[model samples]
Structure formats: structure tokens, C-alpha cells
Target: MSKLGIKDIAARSGVSPATVSRTLRNPELVNKDTRKKVMKAVRESGYTPNRFGSSLRTQQSGNIVVMMPDITNQVNAGIIRAIEVEAQKTGYSVLLGDTQGQEARERHYAQMVSSGQADGILLYTHRLPFDLDNLTANLPPLVNGNESIEVEGLNKVMVDNVQGAKDGVNHLVALGHRRIAAVLGDNNAPSNRERLQGFQQALQQAGIEPDEQYLVQGDYTTESGMKAMEALLKLRKRPTAVFCFNDDMAIGAMSVLREYGYAIPGDISIMGFDDIRYASLMNPPLTTIHQPLEEIGQASMRLLLAQLSGKNSAPQHIQLPLQLVVRQSTGPAPESD
Candidate 1:
């Protein structure tokens, strides 16, 4: 929408400049026929808006770098695809950098962006990859996604993990679950920490005392989830219900429960976060919280584009909504723990 002249569109479509502006900026204000005419003219012109202006001193690469923790993750894969689709519509491309949770790999991507190899950045990380001392130095425009960094003036987009977690746990409590547990993912992630906070808050609201022994840690992997569930089963008073930080961990925990001859949602119930595609395909299906993965990717790209076009100078934080997906995995708690 930026950099292209409105007058040319008006002249080609035989409409007034104001009409062209209205059609481009707010198409809903114009009649459908006029809108179609303007769009046809735009298409004939073969115009794709430039994402960045001539603001920086270095040459533009027409590429934006997206540094993610893991590329093989289903959540990350969906997000990356959406980002690429959105970027292509605006005459820009993406340069994906998978950090693999390695600090050195993160730094490598950080240096690539700062060196003018890309026009801007979309970070899916808990913290900035580069050193804090270079915070004020020459870095490309950036927008954070999936997880948040505490740094000032950085735009961010993510779901409310705490509230989401609370809602997931509260679902189990409403079903008469008194002894509930949580399989937490990597605590280093802000999302995981918020989920933990929510888990505690839900229990306190339900008049259930917080028990440190009920909390187990996982690294957001299926193997880690299995390990966490194994530890929980070893407790003398094992929990009647369990909540996992992500769907992958939940799947892992479910497998362990099966191996131990436990009937899901009959003897115990399970809840998970991030309703990935596989969540619904599980044996009993997964009852989990849904994060809008595609929306996160598209929203992050829009945030960076807003900065690149000088439309927004202030940082903006977008907290997307989360949905509670009810499936066969969660049911009324058994009479005995």
C-alpha cells in the first residue's frame, strides 16, 4: 500500500484520487463494483508494494530473516509457511535461520541481519541473540514472535500463555479433579514460565494447595514428556489429572500412560497446550489449548512491515486469543486418585 502512487491508479481506473485512496485504504467504504475496478487496474499495473523504503544506508536485499528455535517443530513449520506466503504478497522473501536452541547459532543469525544481508527480522526467541552491549548498535528492524523478550521498544506477538494454561487446568478442576499435575516445558521460555504461573493460580483459586512435587519439567520434546510422566508415576500419590505445556509433550505423556496400563480420562485425564495438527489425531484425541500459529506468523510480518514503511515508530505488543479445545482426553475425574 506504500510507495505506489495513488494518482496513477486513479487515472487508469477513471476514478477520482480520493476514490482511489478510499478504495485502497478502506475498500469496504466503496461499492463493490468500484472496488473491483480499482483492483483490476492495480493488477494490470502489476504492482506489489515495496516493504521497505530507502531509510537505511545499506542496499536492500529484498529478504527478511526469521530466526526460530527449531525448524522441524510442527508449530514452527506452520508459522514459517504462513510467513513466506505473507511476505511474497508484499514483494519480499524470507531467509529462514533455524537456531536449534544453540546460542552460537542464534548469534550467527543475529550477525547476518545486522550486516545488511536482510531488510529486517522476525525473531521467535525468548531473548535477543546478540550481546546486550550491542543493543543500541546497528541492527535491522525487528519484531518478536511466539515468545517475548524483555527488551524495551521491541514489537511482540504471542498468545496469553498464562490465561490459556489457567483455562486448561480449570477445565480439569471443574470435572472434579482434586489432585492435578503439570508437565512444564523449558522454563527458559517466557511462555513456559507464564504457563506455570497460570497452573499455580488455577489451583489456588480452586482451594487446592500448591504442591511442589506435582510439578515436573520437560524440554518441549516427546522424550522429555515421557520422562516427566515416568517421574510423576513414581510418586506415592500420583496425580489424577495432568496438564502438559505443549502438544508434543502431551503425546509423549499419553504414550507413557498407555504403557503403564492406564485408561485415559477413565483412570486419569490429560490436557495440553498448542493444539497442533496431531492433537486431534491421537487415540482418544487431545484436549488442549489452541494457539493461532498462522496468525502469529502473519501478524509478525505485518508488524515489521509497519516499521519498515515508517507508519509506526512505537513498539506494539499483540496478545492473540486462545481457545480451549475439548476432546475425549479430558473427562470427569474418577472417584479415587
Candidate 2:
């Protein structure tokens, strides 16, 4: 009576050890009568399967690490919730890693998967934390969520950022706004680059040349938005409308406009991306792009699950739809005083 093992449970249930192992590892493969007997024996024996030992032997931890560049971003909260819920449904757990845009932290979290502490990874950063060459030798299952970083053999679940930004900017262009300003996220980020491209594309389609003075680079923070707006306001030819890369930046710019005694959509219109919870509750409701964040999260986790189960031989990419949500914050270009 030193310790209980699978052989003890198999002996008590009158089944082979393999059958007992299969029953515990995958109950669906075993028939009902056999499964019930094995479970009954397991209950009677008070034998809890050693998860760590099983993982060590099988090389599967049943845990996925979700790495986010910025945990404080409100938009990421929905994605995390969806991932956690879906993972729990499949008898898996989630380990959250907030890299805070640091290369060392991202690499450290990726190492956990290679070390068997996690079976897979879900990345929200613009680039992979670890080297591609090292990962190729023993590729642990990896999925990209929300942000798209082009990799040769990685699945990505995201909204079309370029199209979403184009739609938001087109809405302003249709309102006769030729002098539109842009508050951009990290200039070096792929997502921001795609969005800026869309902004310029939309203006070009409408026969308006993009003015460099109206383009302000931000860090996707409210404080950056405020400073960018202040610089735009000082321009001799102020923009009649402004588009912020994210809701927090848009809200910050709006606050600055208010402090300057400027009325929203009357003196200058404003719009943003990522229709966050606070968008609709703003003073004049924010116009923005709606991304299915929860769906993006769920799809990424499901892709990783498929990879872990050997259901996918090649990478799978999914692009969710985006919509232009028109609220009161955006309107026609104001007349010059």
C-alpha cells in the first residue's frame, strides 16, 4: 500500500493497463460499460492521476500560454476572457503572459512552451518573441491572435486592420473632410503600418493628397493622443476631422478638444478604432471600427487545440469581419471661421 498506480486500477476493474490508460487519457475511445467500470474502480481506489508525470511522459501539458504585449489595454480583456472560457471547455488551462512590449519577457514566455510547461502559445505581439530558426527544430503549437505578424507556418486569427481603418477613414472622407488628421499607434508596429496605409489609401481614392503635417505618431495611449491633438491644433490649417488608432487615444483627443472650447463634430469631428465599451458612453458617442475581439480570441484557442490534437497538418488563418460604427462623434466637416 505504498502508492496506487494505473495497474492497481486496471486489476481492480479486470481490464488491461492500456485500457485503463486509454480510459483516463481519452474516455471517448473506450466503450460505455468499460468506461463506467474503469471510472468506478478509479473512484473506489481514490487514485488521482499524476498530471505532471503524465505530461512528462506524453510531452503534453494541457496548458497554453497566451502572451499579450499590453495587458492594461482594455481591448485585450475581451480576447483574454474568450480564450480562457474556450480553453476551460476543452479541459485545458490558460497561462497569461504580459510581455509589455519587452523582447526578453516575450522570449521567456515562449521558452515555457518549449520546456513542456505549456503545450502551445497564443501571441498578441506584432512579432514572435523567439527566433524562427530555433522554433523550427521543434515547433511547439503557436497561434497569432488579434495582431497579424506574417510567419511562414503560423496560424493567425484577426480582423483585417487595413480594411477596418480604411472604412473608418472613408466615413470621414464621405463627409467632405479633405484635411483629416491621424493619430497613429506605434509607428514601427505592423498593425499601425497597415492602418496608416489604409488611411492614406482612403484619402488618395478621394483625390486628396495626405498632408504630412496632419500625421502624428502615437503610442496607442491616451496621453499620446492628447499631445498629438495639441500639435495638430497649433497647425495653421487645422484638420476638420481626426482619426485615432484606438479608442483610448480618441477619447484623450476628445478631452483635449473640449478643454480648448471646441465642440465635437461641430468644430472638428473625431473617430477611432476598436469599439471599446467606453466608446458609446462618451459625451457625444464615438464613431469607430468594430472588431469581433471575442471571436478572434476563441478562434485562436481553437486553432491551437487542433494543432495539439494533430487535427491540422498545415497552418490555418482566419480573418474576422469589421464594420464602421457611426456614432455622434463623427459628422460633416465644419465650416471655416
Tens digit of lDDT per residue, candidate 2, span 1-337?
7688888899999999899999988999999999999999999889888787788788888889999987778788889889999999999999989998899999999999878899899999888887877665566789987778877788888778889888988899899888999999987678788889888898888899879999999989999999999999999989999999989999999999999999999999999999998899999999999878789889999999998888867778898888899999998887674
RMSD per model, one decimal: 7.2, 2.5
Stretches of candidate 2 above 4 Å error? 1-19, 26-34, 41-47, 132-138
C-alpha lDDT score of every prediction, in listed order: 0.88, 0.89
| TM-score per model over all chains | 0.82, 0.91
- In candidate 1, which residue ranges exceed 4 Å CA deviation? 1-58, 137-139
Model 2: lowest-lDDT 10 consecutive positions: 131-140
Per-prediction tally of clashes: 0, 0
Report the C-alpha displacement of residue 12, candidate 2, in angstroms: 6.4
